[model samples]
Target: MPGQVTLELDPSLFGEREKRVAHSGKLVATAFRYKSGVAGLRVDNGAGTVTLLPFQGQQVWDAVFFGRSLTMKSMFDEPQPTRDYLRTYGALFLHCGGTSMGNPGPTDTHPLHGELPNLPHTDAQLVFGEDEAGAYLDLTGIARDAKAFHHDFVSRPRVRIREGATSLDMAVDVENRAGKPLPFLYLAHINFRPVDGAVLIDSVRDDRADATVRQPHLAQDEDEAVVAYHRAIAADPSSHRTLKAGVPIQPELVQTMKAAGAADGWTHALQRHPNGSGDFVSWRPDDLPYAVRWLTRGPDQDALGLVLPATAAPDGLAAATANRQIVWVAPGAAYRTSFRFGALDPAAANGLEATIKTIRGG
Candidate 1:
């Protein structure tokens, strides 16, 4: 009833077909190839194509639809992270920040983002099977993050793309391997490129959370040529208040989800893609209550990234802990969460309201 709402879709054609996965020039199988230190795998599940980077933080480097990329890659020409670590950017990857994404908050000793991007997955697997969808393919990997005396954690990611479908799903499981309760942060650092003239539209189910706008106007900062544009958006008033972006609220009654676990309830958002379609990413609100938008619309770099995290703001470990926004994993325990990425045809309907109703189904 507020703002300009526009969305469209065809639910009936959301057809049921057997999915598939394969390697380059081959069907019903998978393989790994490398160029220098970079390694990647080609995945085609009948409908779309995905290139998975096994060595580059175990992320999907490309998700292609209709012979075009629906995902964004950083403008940093180089495909992999450099020796400097922080310069390692781009590709629709995971955890640009890390288990501790964001700025070196209060007790940060690592670089910006985190070490996850450069940390290679020591173990992995590729498998194909026939499920309810008839046929499917997925790649699973296990990576560990253990500091000498800090925190020891494990990440298990399984990426799945269905055959004849315009979508991909990533299911990640994180475990605290330390003896004492350890703090944790997780984000699906999704980046999209060529967003120079892209129109972005997102909705808040509750109310608009205070969004901390970065220096969006500055193409470059005094220190270094500004490399990116980003925004930290809260899912609820509680977390927004902690950023001092707004007034205070009853701490207990409010859903400071970033601080707590996403035990129940969920949140969703849709964006009119720069490629004439729509890209939608949704997650359990209790798991990733905060959303961050990184736009690379600068003179130096050109791209856009949407980071939905289990915690609020990739500011740092200290700020998250202080705001009670950290996802605390009990000693020797684990947690699991997932997010969905799919494309829709906004032109299916005549106008925005019809589009929204068609996709959401009224």
Candidate 2:
């Protein structure tokens, strides 16, 4: 059980804005809404709309584009998409799998993905401002993961979205508030509904697994999941045997992957839309050296996830720590990282390669 604590909202720490502590009304700024077992917040940055669960890992539950939403509504049975059912029911709470992702074996009782996703967040504040670059909304939140007499860690997340920008930027600082050193594994789970013609592409070769788990062909409005394991460390995301097709996840069924061993030099990954539109995710490789791709392509509970991890793998605390893949923070030290997600629809006549190179500025 984690203890609760209050925190101050420091707009000044973010540095100078083009205007004063500029603010916007909820219509154009940020608003907090109530949802089942959690509090949902929406940020409308003029160019796009982002709805997230502030108390629940600040998970970005929905990304609305044009008129359709780009995220999955977890309950597969419901054909219609609505916020009420999503907030109250099981929606994708995408976040970093606590210290790991895999089964930690029987000795450890931690469930898949660790304690971070299910834990609640606290001390939240929303602010809007503009700089010379653009208008933006910023959400500041503080939360903790701890046991009654064990480790206590606090994470401060600064999420920003700019006006006229299709992407979201998140910078989080995590610290060990406890008295002893802490070992940790971290992975970001950003899930989106499968879009027609959407494919995953990356800059580096992947180190993939040898094991494969195939799924059944599902009809529209049906749900299923299977994972393909990568036993060897290869090149990057694109090289994994399961992803060699380089095609958008089949929209007809559910699919998932658990591959590890990331490579260097690549800073971003791209998901291209059939209409020539696409999404790009960029991060500091030093902070997030690894990544994972999960496509819950079930027509009923559709979600295409691009997981960027701060460790080598999402296996679990015991496995990662044992392999020296987990990062350790001293009692008085802090760990920090940031990543950006945005979309681009270049007018180029080039294919996926050209689209990818343009997004990454290669």
Candidate 3:
């Protein structure tokens, strides 16, 4: 018995942009026919919008602005790979890994699930969940082994919107619907493209890490010193038994956040300017702790989608847990977390500093 709302999208907004079925107004996922084989998501609550490029050789892609497109050929730099089922971006929710428990797979293979490696106990799922309302997905008979979809590969998720409003409120339910005791990791992979000067603001860390190079295998490079630091944290008994801090704001990354209406490089925090509308917000889940930051800046950056991952765990589940960065949940349990996205003109407003103070109640 949760309150719901619907999403409204203008097809004309992006010509040839195919629209997905709008359930109860919580989400409207759109696909561009003539563009980069990308899809965009519009949540009902003004929480902010996200875009995904399923064909851009990446698992996820995101952006704040709309209408901009990248060429498919320009993206992968090769002829069309398998146009068949390329697992681009969409909300990914499932128990993925190649292990049972106690032992986990390598960080690179963490997202891919199977048996044999005896991966760590990890569960990761992403779906719009309830704020102050109730649950979103009606988990009346969701079987743990049940295929996410009936016949169609894409999940036919359900949602509802009460009155016609510009915003949306939805629910996402996670339970131990599986028969066996399930161990897993959950995350909302909100991917964002890093435009030059695009400052990312989050307080998920107590101490700021100098901008680290993002390696393909892990969130950060495999520096001997960094690995040693992680090992030390893992050995600490006073920590939370996970590798996350959960601080949602950072000033150094902000210096790297790029401005809007740009073609390359990074943007400083989007201040309320004479011509700009500053809007940014995030969540502070008590369970998840570590936050991730990433940006792939290059001439073909647009062709290659980037991820400024704001995570609650560092690296993979095993590493994260070792560092005391895990969210423990009781069996047959349910919880909710939410954030807001709105305008805060930095020039006219208190700038990024004022906005952070407002969000943190500082």
Candidate 4:
């Protein structure tokens, strides 16, 4: 059986000099606190390091492999202890949704991307164990979202890293406490920093004709250039696959795609850089039927969000309901999803490209 240790949130225990808490072979787990008083956990698996914010919805703040950072560049330098999404929006991997997800409609009142991101967790711990593959370390936390006499649910999010590995695995389970069927929506907002001249390989067709553009509701004061760009993508959805330097894909360009799974029922996506390095993600299409491609390039912020797996599009509650995309969980039942994100070396990147080609029946 795996052993668990409750994390002690004492400031002194996690000071700048006293961060390391546990060590086994080449794996090390450390707990620390940000200057803003938010608690965080960091794990180093010899090849890379990942910092997780256990207090703030267990979001991944940073991931570095072989001296290359995988996290996107944002205006904010550190995570803030606020509920405002924009203020604390910088994360490598952000979990979005609960009962409702996405931007609220004209009559909807839920916050943007639901109430999961930046929501504080009630408890957190470290779980360590060894399996057939090897030794592993896990950082787990409990988060709940409820209202007075309304929908109530709990979510347990975990991040795991194995010895001397460059990859990270994420899993979450959400259980409904309400006595009736509970509506649910979820999106894994895995953001990767843009690398110029990187080729995107995914389960979707390489051509633009196979994609569908989803226009988000823009404000009256939205930039005209952005609006025009959206129109361009809507006119030709296939033109949004490649990443070019200095070419602005401002605001955001979102496209809905029908993912093609491999023999094992999992879909793979990779952003292979010009230098033969890459970043990849893998998930089961059955667990998340919809794949959304999000891209935003600006002077202050740049993100290449490839293959954002979700139950439905982020078009708010009314639109999802109208489209019949809402997933319902029975009373006392749970909804679960898992995915993998990692950095790939030259050989690994080439191997993945070949595997992707095979999956595409090339």
Reference-based lDDT, residue 295, model 4: 88
Ranking by TM-score: 4, 1, 2, 3
Q: For candidate 2, lDDT tens digit of each residue in 1-362?
A: 12212233333322222222224543253343342223445656666677766566666667775555666657632112232223333343345654455445545566666655545665666655666765567767878888767677887777776776677787877788889877766666666555555666654432234222233343555322232222111223343323322333343221223322224433666666677676666665667776555554433555655445456555566767667877778897877877776566645213545634554443
Clashes of 2: 14
For candidate 4, the C-alpha RMSD (Å) to the true structure equals 2.4
Per residue, candidate 3 scores C-alpha lDDT tens digits across 1-362 of: 23433233332333455555343344444434434323233333223343322222222222232232111111433222222222322221111221122123365443332221111111212243355453342111121223332111111112222222211222223444434433444433332332333333433222223223222332454445444444443354113112232211111121111112112211222212233433333334332222333222223322111222222333455664576544443445533333222234345335554444443332
Candidates in order: C-alpha RMSD to true structure:
11.9, 8.7, 12.4, 2.4
Task: Give the runs in model 1 whose Cα sits over 4 Å from its true position.
Answer: 1-34, 81-85, 96-99, 194-197, 205-209, 215-264, 273-276, 347-362
Please report the TM-score between candidate 1 and the true structure. Answer: 0.71
**Which window of ten consecutive residues has the lowest lDDT sum in model 1?**
245-254
- lDDT of residue 274 for candidate 2: 72
Q: Kindly indicate the candidate among 2 and 3 with the higher lDDT.
A: 2
lDDT of each: 0.54, 0.54, 0.29, 0.82
lDDT tens digits, residue span 59-144, model 4: 99999997988999999788889988888888999899887887788878888888788878877777777788788888887888
lDDT of 3 at 333: 53
Q: Count the backbone clashes (under 3 Å) in each candidate.
A: 12, 14, 72, 1
User: All candidates' TM-scores?
Assistant: 0.71, 0.70, 0.45, 0.92
In model 4, where do residues sit more than 4 Å from their true spots?
Answer: 2-12, 16-18, 206-210, 216-232
